[model samples]
Target: MANDAIPVRTERAMMRREDNPFTFLQQEIDRLFDGFGRSFPAFAPPQAMMPRMDVSETDKTIEISAELPGLETKDVQLSLADNTLTIRGEKKSEREEQDKDYHLIERSFGAFSRSVALPEGVKAEDVSAEIAKGVLKVTVKKPAPKQSRQIDIKTAA
Candidate 1:
Protein backbone atom coordinates (compact mmCIF):
# COMPACT_ATOMS: atom_id res chain seq x y z
CA MET A 1 0.00 0.00 0.00
CA ALA A 2 1.31 3.48 -0.94
CA ASN A 3 1.47 6.08 1.86
CA ASP A 4 -0.36 9.36 1.12
CA ALA A 5 0.02 12.69 2.95
CA ILE A 6 -3.11 14.70 3.72
CA PRO A 7 -3.11 18.47 3.00
CA VAL A 8 -4.10 20.89 5.77
CA ARG A 9 -5.44 24.36 5.13
CA THR A 10 -5.58 27.35 7.47
CA GLU A 11 -8.56 29.72 7.40
CA ARG A 12 -8.21 33.49 7.57
CA ALA A 13 -10.45 35.58 9.81
CA MET A 14 -13.09 37.65 8.02
CA MET A 15 -13.05 41.44 8.54
CA ARG A 16 -16.00 42.65 10.56
CA ARG A 17 -17.96 45.86 9.91
CA GLU A 18 -18.61 46.68 13.57
CA ASP A 19 -19.66 50.19 14.60
CA ASN A 20 -17.64 51.88 17.35
CA PRO A 21 -19.58 52.14 20.62
CA PHE A 22 -18.66 55.78 21.19
CA THR A 23 -19.57 56.85 17.62
CA PHE A 24 -22.85 54.89 17.71
CA LEU A 25 -23.78 56.42 21.05
CA GLN A 26 -22.99 59.92 19.79
CA GLN A 27 -25.11 59.40 16.68
CA GLU A 28 -28.02 58.08 18.72
CA ILE A 29 -27.83 61.03 21.12
CA ASP A 30 -27.66 63.48 18.25
CA ARG A 31 -30.76 61.89 16.73
CA LEU A 32 -32.61 62.15 20.05
CA PHE A 33 -31.65 65.80 20.39
CA ASP A 34 -32.24 66.69 16.74
CA GLY A 35 -35.35 68.72 17.56
CA PHE A 36 -33.67 70.51 20.46
CA GLY A 37 -32.09 73.13 18.19
CA ARG A 38 -35.45 73.92 16.58
CA SER A 39 -37.06 74.45 19.99
CA PHE A 40 -34.24 76.64 21.36
CA PRO A 41 -32.69 78.18 18.30
CA ALA A 42 -32.08 81.48 20.02
CA PHE A 43 -30.10 79.82 22.82
CA ALA A 44 -27.61 78.36 20.38
CA PRO A 45 -24.48 80.30 19.57
CA PRO A 46 -21.52 79.42 17.37
CA GLN A 47 -18.74 78.30 19.67
CA ALA A 48 -15.47 76.56 19.00
CA MET A 49 -14.60 73.30 20.73
CA MET A 50 -12.24 73.32 23.66
CA PRO A 51 -8.58 72.46 23.11
CA ARG A 52 -6.81 69.49 24.69
CA MET A 53 -4.52 70.05 27.69
CA ASP A 54 -1.66 68.37 29.52
CA VAL A 55 -1.55 68.42 33.33
CA SER A 56 1.26 67.41 35.66
CA GLU A 57 1.62 67.35 39.43
CA THR A 58 4.37 66.98 42.04
CA ASP A 59 4.61 66.88 45.82
CA LYS A 60 5.38 70.57 46.14
CA THR A 61 3.25 71.99 43.34
CA ILE A 62 1.03 71.25 40.34
CA GLU A 63 2.04 72.37 36.87
CA ILE A 64 -0.36 72.90 33.98
CA SER A 65 0.92 73.73 30.54
CA ALA A 66 -1.15 74.39 27.45
CA GLU A 67 -0.21 75.04 23.84
CA LEU A 68 -1.53 78.36 22.63
CA PRO A 69 0.60 79.32 19.68
CA GLY A 70 0.30 82.83 18.17
CA LEU A 71 -1.72 83.99 21.20
CA GLU A 72 -0.48 86.88 23.25
CA THR A 73 -0.76 87.17 27.04
CA LYS A 74 -3.59 89.68 26.61
CA ASP A 75 -5.62 87.14 24.67
CA VAL A 76 -5.47 84.39 27.32
CA GLN A 77 -7.35 84.19 30.59
CA LEU A 78 -6.51 81.98 33.56
CA SER A 79 -8.71 81.57 36.59
CA LEU A 80 -9.15 79.29 39.58
CA ALA A 81 -12.50 78.72 41.26
CA ASP A 82 -13.73 76.02 43.65
CA ASN A 83 -10.65 73.82 43.16
CA THR A 84 -11.00 74.07 39.39
CA LEU A 85 -8.45 75.78 37.16
CA THR A 86 -9.59 77.09 33.80
CA ILE A 87 -7.65 78.41 30.84
CA ARG A 88 -9.45 80.26 28.09
CA GLY A 89 -8.17 81.99 25.00
CA GLU A 90 -8.95 83.03 21.45
CA LYS A 91 -6.88 82.99 18.27
CA LYS A 92 -7.54 85.71 15.74
CA SER A 93 -6.18 86.10 12.24
CA GLU A 94 -6.30 89.31 10.29
CA ARG A 95 -5.27 90.03 6.75
CA GLU A 96 -2.32 92.38 6.55
CA GLU A 97 -3.37 93.58 3.08
CA GLN A 98 -6.90 93.77 1.70
CA ASP A 99 -5.74 92.99 -1.82
CA LYS A 100 -3.96 89.78 -0.79
CA ASP A 101 -6.16 86.69 -1.16
CA TYR A 102 -5.57 83.73 1.14
CA HIS A 103 -5.12 80.54 -0.83
CA LEU A 104 -5.43 78.34 2.25
CA ILE A 105 -6.46 78.96 5.85
CA GLU A 106 -5.75 75.70 7.63
CA ARG A 107 -4.79 77.26 10.96
CA SER A 108 -7.39 76.98 13.70
CA PHE A 109 -8.92 80.10 15.21
CA GLY A 110 -11.65 81.11 17.72
CA ALA A 111 -12.22 80.59 21.43
CA PHE A 112 -11.03 77.59 23.42
CA SER A 113 -11.44 76.81 27.10
CA ARG A 114 -10.03 73.99 29.22
CA SER A 115 -10.51 73.20 32.91
CA VAL A 116 -8.71 70.84 35.29
CA ALA A 117 -9.48 69.73 38.81
CA LEU A 118 -7.06 70.99 41.48
CA PRO A 119 -5.64 68.44 43.87
CA GLU A 120 -6.87 68.27 47.48
CA GLY A 121 -3.83 70.01 49.00
CA VAL A 122 -3.41 72.73 46.39
CA LYS A 123 -3.45 76.34 47.64
CA ALA A 124 -5.57 78.38 45.28
CA GLU A 125 -4.24 81.68 46.58
CA ASP A 126 -0.65 80.75 45.92
CA VAL A 127 -1.30 79.78 42.33
CA SER A 128 0.82 81.54 39.71
CA ALA A 129 0.55 81.72 35.97
CA GLU A 130 2.72 82.89 33.10
CA ILE A 131 2.64 82.85 29.33
CA ALA A 132 6.01 82.52 27.65
CA LYS A 133 6.68 81.96 23.95
CA GLY A 134 3.07 80.94 23.20
CA VAL A 135 2.88 78.41 26.05
CA LEU A 136 0.80 79.00 29.15
CA LYS A 137 2.35 77.75 32.38
CA VAL A 138 0.39 77.56 35.62
CA THR A 139 1.93 76.52 38.93
CA VAL A 140 -0.11 75.90 42.07
CA LYS A 141 1.62 75.42 45.41
CA LYS A 142 0.57 72.43 47.51
CA PRO A 143 -0.54 73.24 51.04
CA ALA A 144 1.51 71.72 53.83
CA PRO A 145 -0.43 69.42 56.16
CA LYS A 146 -0.44 69.95 59.91
CA GLN A 147 1.95 67.64 61.74
CA SER A 148 0.39 65.21 64.23
CA ARG A 149 2.07 64.41 67.53
CA GLN A 150 2.46 60.80 68.67
CA ILE A 151 0.41 59.97 71.82
CA ASP A 152 1.79 57.36 74.23
CA ILE A 153 -0.66 55.22 76.23
CA LYS A 154 0.20 54.32 79.85
CA THR A 155 -1.25 51.20 81.56
CA ALA A 156 -2.82 51.66 85.00
CA ALA A 157 -1.85 49.30 87.86
Candidate 2:
Protein backbone atom coordinates (compact mmCIF):
# COMPACT_ATOMS: atom_id res chain seq x y z
CA MET A 1 0.00 0.00 0.00
CA ALA A 2 2.86 2.42 0.74
CA ASN A 3 4.38 1.79 -2.72
CA ASP A 4 1.10 2.83 -4.34
CA ALA A 5 1.15 6.27 -2.74
CA ILE A 6 1.87 9.14 -5.17
CA PRO A 7 4.52 11.75 -4.52
CA VAL A 8 3.30 15.32 -3.82
CA ARG A 9 5.09 18.23 -5.48
CA THR A 10 4.83 21.34 -3.31
CA GLU A 11 6.45 23.93 -5.59
CA ARG A 12 4.18 26.91 -6.21
CA ALA A 13 2.92 27.11 -9.75
CA MET A 14 3.94 30.15 -11.78
CA MET A 15 1.09 32.59 -12.31
CA ARG A 16 0.77 34.37 -15.62
CA ARG A 17 0.66 38.17 -15.41
CA GLU A 18 -1.68 39.72 -17.94
CA ASP A 19 -2.03 43.38 -18.92
CA ASN A 20 -4.74 44.46 -16.45
CA PRO A 21 -5.87 47.68 -18.07
CA PHE A 22 -6.83 46.04 -21.36
CA THR A 23 -8.36 43.08 -19.58
CA PHE A 24 -10.39 45.30 -17.29
CA LEU A 25 -11.59 47.41 -20.18
CA GLN A 26 -12.60 44.32 -22.11
CA GLN A 27 -14.46 42.97 -19.12
CA GLU A 28 -16.30 46.27 -18.65
CA ILE A 29 -17.28 46.38 -22.29
CA ASP A 30 -18.54 42.81 -22.13
CA ARG A 31 -20.58 43.60 -19.03
CA LEU A 32 -22.13 46.60 -20.76
CA PHE A 33 -23.18 44.58 -23.79
CA ASP A 34 -24.43 41.73 -21.63
CA GLY A 35 -26.65 44.10 -19.74
CA PHE A 36 -27.85 45.86 -22.88
CA GLY A 37 -30.00 42.94 -24.04
CA ARG A 38 -31.58 42.53 -20.64
CA SER A 39 -32.08 46.22 -19.96
CA PHE A 40 -35.43 46.08 -21.73
CA PRO A 41 -36.73 43.09 -19.84
CA ALA A 42 -40.22 43.35 -21.26
CA PHE A 43 -39.00 43.00 -24.85
CA ALA A 44 -36.14 40.62 -24.26
CA PRO A 45 -36.41 37.19 -25.85
CA PRO A 46 -36.35 34.00 -23.80
CA GLN A 47 -33.50 32.65 -25.74
CA ALA A 48 -31.06 34.83 -27.64
CA MET A 49 -27.63 33.95 -28.96
CA MET A 50 -25.12 36.49 -30.09
CA PRO A 51 -22.90 35.27 -32.85
CA ARG A 52 -19.13 35.54 -32.44
CA MET A 53 -17.67 38.01 -34.86
CA ASP A 54 -14.27 39.31 -35.87
CA VAL A 55 -13.34 42.56 -37.55
CA SER A 56 -10.04 43.42 -39.19
CA GLU A 57 -8.70 46.17 -41.39
CA THR A 58 -5.88 46.83 -43.79
CA ASP A 59 -4.81 49.78 -45.83
CA LYS A 60 -7.21 49.04 -48.65
CA THR A 61 -10.15 47.25 -47.10
CA ILE A 62 -11.92 46.41 -43.86
CA GLU A 63 -13.09 42.86 -43.29
CA ILE A 64 -15.67 41.44 -40.95
CA SER A 65 -16.49 37.82 -40.27
CA ALA A 66 -19.11 36.21 -38.10
CA GLU A 67 -19.70 32.62 -37.12
CA LEU A 68 -23.35 31.85 -37.76
CA PRO A 69 -23.72 28.14 -37.51
CA GLY A 70 -27.01 26.54 -38.63
CA LEU A 71 -27.98 29.69 -40.49
CA GLU A 72 -28.13 30.38 -44.21
CA THR A 73 -27.95 33.51 -46.30
CA LYS A 74 -31.72 33.58 -46.73
CA ASP A 75 -32.23 33.66 -42.99
CA VAL A 76 -30.05 36.74 -42.51
CA GLN A 77 -30.52 40.34 -43.50
CA LEU A 78 -27.77 42.92 -43.81
CA SER A 79 -28.16 46.66 -44.11
CA LEU A 80 -25.81 49.64 -44.09
CA ALA A 81 -26.85 53.19 -43.32
CA ASP A 82 -25.21 56.20 -41.66
CA ASN A 83 -21.88 54.40 -41.58
CA THR A 84 -23.37 51.56 -39.55
CA LEU A 85 -23.67 47.97 -40.69
CA THR A 86 -26.38 45.87 -39.15
CA ILE A 87 -26.95 42.14 -39.27
CA ARG A 88 -30.28 40.68 -38.25
CA GLY A 89 -31.60 37.15 -38.25
CA GLU A 90 -34.15 34.85 -36.72
CA LYS A 91 -33.77 31.15 -35.89
CA LYS A 92 -36.65 28.76 -35.51
CA SER A 93 -36.75 25.07 -34.67
CA GLU A 94 -39.71 22.77 -34.24
CA ARG A 95 -40.02 19.09 -33.55
CA GLU A 96 -43.20 17.04 -33.14
CA GLU A 97 -43.82 13.35 -32.65
CA GLN A 98 -47.03 11.51 -31.94
CA ASP A 99 -47.74 7.85 -31.85
CA LYS A 100 -49.58 5.72 -29.24
CA ASP A 101 -49.02 6.61 -25.62
CA TYR A 102 -47.62 10.14 -25.69
CA HIS A 103 -47.08 13.13 -27.92
CA LEU A 104 -43.95 15.20 -27.70
CA ILE A 105 -43.54 18.64 -29.17
CA GLU A 106 -40.65 21.09 -29.00
CA ARG A 107 -40.27 24.53 -30.38
CA SER A 108 -37.66 27.27 -30.17
CA PHE A 109 -37.48 30.69 -31.70
CA GLY A 110 -35.04 33.57 -31.35
CA ALA A 111 -34.05 36.78 -33.04
CA PHE A 112 -30.72 38.60 -32.88
CA SER A 113 -29.34 41.81 -34.23
CA ARG A 114 -25.83 43.28 -34.17
CA SER A 115 -24.46 46.44 -35.64
CA VAL A 116 -20.93 47.69 -36.33
CA ALA A 117 -19.94 51.31 -36.71
CA LEU A 118 -17.74 51.87 -39.69
CA PRO A 119 -15.25 54.64 -40.09
CA GLU A 120 -16.06 57.76 -42.06
CA GLY A 121 -16.12 57.53 -45.87
CA VAL A 122 -17.36 53.93 -45.92
CA LYS A 123 -19.96 53.83 -48.67
CA ALA A 124 -22.75 51.31 -48.87
CA GLU A 125 -21.94 50.53 -52.49
CA ASP A 126 -18.39 49.62 -51.51
CA VAL A 127 -19.50 46.89 -49.11
CA SER A 128 -20.17 43.24 -49.94
CA ALA A 129 -21.35 40.34 -47.82
CA GLU A 130 -21.25 36.61 -48.41
CA ILE A 131 -21.89 33.53 -46.32
CA ALA A 132 -20.20 30.19 -46.84
CA LYS A 133 -20.06 27.12 -44.59
CA GLY A 134 -21.72 28.85 -41.67
CA VAL A 135 -19.44 31.89 -41.78
CA LEU A 136 -20.49 35.35 -42.95
CA LYS A 137 -17.79 37.53 -44.42
CA VAL A 138 -18.15 41.19 -45.22
CA THR A 139 -15.59 43.34 -46.98
CA VAL A 140 -15.66 47.12 -47.20
CA LYS A 141 -13.40 48.82 -49.67
CA LYS A 142 -11.76 51.76 -47.97
CA PRO A 143 -11.97 55.09 -49.73
CA ALA A 144 -8.88 56.93 -50.82
CA PRO A 145 -7.24 58.94 -48.11
CA LYS A 146 -8.22 62.56 -48.20
CA GLN A 147 -5.54 65.25 -48.15
CA SER A 148 -5.36 67.23 -44.93
CA ARG A 149 -5.01 71.00 -44.94
CA GLN A 150 -4.28 73.42 -42.15
CA ILE A 151 -6.94 75.96 -41.27
CA ASP A 152 -5.91 79.40 -40.06
CA ILE A 153 -6.81 80.10 -36.43
CA LYS A 154 -8.57 83.40 -35.83
CA THR A 155 -8.58 85.18 -32.49
CA ALA A 156 -11.79 86.76 -31.26
CA ALA A 157 -11.52 90.54 -30.76
Question: Which of the numbered candidates is closest to the native, going by highest lDDT?
Answer: 2
| Stretches > 4 Å off in candidate 1 | 1-49, 96-103, 146-157
Q: Can you list the residue pairs that collide in candidate 2?
A: none
TM-score of candidate 2 on Cα atoms, chains taken together: 0.58
Q: Kindly give the stretch of ten consecutive residues in candidate 1 with the minimal lDDT sum.
A: 9-18
RMSD per candidate (Å) reads: 11.5, 13.8
Per-model lDDT: 0.73, 0.79
TM-scores, all candidates, are: 0.57, 0.58
- For model 2, residues 1-157, the per-residue Cα lDDT tens digits are 4565786544433323354567678888999888865765434455446777999999899999987887899899999988899998987665566576965323334677889999888888999999999899999998888999999999999
